[model samples]
Target: IFCSQYMSWTRNYGVQGTIFPAPNFNPVADAQMLAGALQGFGCDKDTLVAVLTQRSTAQRLTIAEAYQSVLGRDLIGDLREKLSDHFKDVMVGLMYPPPSYDAHELWHAMKGAGTEENCLIDILASRTNGEIFQMREAYYLQYGSNLQEDIYSETSGHFRDTLMNLVQGTREEGYTDPAMAAQDAMVLWEACQQKTGEHKTMLQMILCNKSYQQLWLVFQEFQNISGQDIVDAINECYDGYFQELLVAIVLCVRDKPAYFAYRLYSAIHDFGFHNKTVIRILIARSEIDLMTIRKRYKERYGKSLFHDIKNFASGHYEKALLAICAGDAEDY
Candidate 1:
């Protein structure tokens, strides 16, 4: 949805990205500074956080290349040696291109004893068709496993079916038809009302097949006829990961940045950090729309994400998140 219309969408909405190509960015110079930060006894955590967090992913990759050329050492390897825990995770996550990072997260999410269903949902449900394709390609290249096959083995039932549909990355893009929206809305309302196991695939088909633009129209048409939000209906009709996956898709379609804002809020609101979720959202969206997510975070939660991070997180981890956050919405 976002990929196909990205050019037009950014033009219409204006990009609210937090990070960009650093001005006067000399990769060799930046690499030298990073080497200096990493070389000494204890490593300079402050310099590492400041330099890495502020640059775009593209810029960071260039710096990494320069680091290898200048010092004959791998930047990511050096970071792994020096940094530890969640702080190290965040720094390492920042170095990869977006597709590789997403692939890495997805691989780990499904790698161990149990699948991190939320990680799968967070990534697959929210990505555009092109993004999904890249991730699938990366997953194969890096892990030598098919993403869809891995997902199929890891999950089951209606939830598995839904993920399978999404993994195909075949959603219709851009164009919308209001007439179809009205028809699909009725179809969805009836399916929800039935709540029969029979209608599960039907629900998945409509939600997964339509363009995001068309789906938004369907949702509005749904509200007009049913007098309840589509999410509420899905909640009423479904249970478990199936319901959660559907809800994530709907929210992402409605407002991608706002959906991510809710994710950041949920991650930190539980008194301690859900470090993986927190790190994923901030790093993934840093170049795309973290600024707008910050704006929505304030609008939805009534406090700045930065403020919440400071309250729930401490030390270098907090600093890296804040640096990605750029600053509080209130400051702007």
Candidate 2:
């Protein structure tokens, strides 16, 4: 699912991740402490945060299993009763495996009356097809529902078609071709440049079908021939979620860390701070290129992501994020 591009990304930025499995861990001990924390009159929310956030997701999953075996209680269900809001979100997020967490978010986005279109766009537009496929499997296991079916029922028309194709989990992979890149660029140009009306399928096909390596080359060729970026052209012609999805694909292909940094920045800069989005990316990317994303955030926004988190978020939620924001890369 991932490519050598990500290795180059990690190398260029020197950002690996922020979290790892704790040394000399004891899941039974964790389960016991969690039981002790929850047994008191006033729940030890602080204890809950400490126990949950300090461990890796894999370790947390082990704790959940051991908690079940030792106390015969679901650690997550107990936490569900004990915590709320963003605090609960980050903690619960730590418990879910990455693919399942993504699946849960996708389910949340579509299960209710209205869709969180941005969440939908951010996830679908950003994930590799293999990640989406694993998420689909997790969604089915978690909810007994096919992701594609749910999406089909929840959405309609061109946007629906785009998402359906995206979820197919079959995109062009392997080597980048310079000659084919120029040809594909011309195809994309025709797709968006027609005077009568834009051919969205052409754009969707190119974005959904090509490998990121190939797409990067194609985007370079696209700018060379068109004299403007594809993103600018999309903004000039398209509207709403369609535009957002396409732009996300372009940003993701161009620089994934930058795309996430944009999301992180939006989550923080807006009124009231989009805490769910903030927590989602922060926790989700903690083990990936969050350090890279943080660097990009600073480069793009002229401020540190950690400084903004300290300023806007508080208590255990802030602490957990700050700890993860510590950078996965050793010596960051």
Stretches of candidate 1 off by over 4 Å are 1-13, 327-332
Residue 36, candidate 2: alpha-carbon lDDT: 91
Task: List where candidate 2 sits over 4 angstroms from the true fold.
Answer: 1-15, 195-198, 328-332
The digit string of per-residue lDDT tens for model 1 on 200-273 reads: 88889888889999998999999999999999999998889999999999999999999988888887886367
Candidate lDDT values, in order:
0.89, 0.83
Q: All candidates: CA RMSD in angstroms?
A: 3.7, 4.0
For all candidates, what are the clash counts? Answer: 0, 3
Taking all chains together, each candidate's TM-score versus the true structure is: 0.94, 0.91
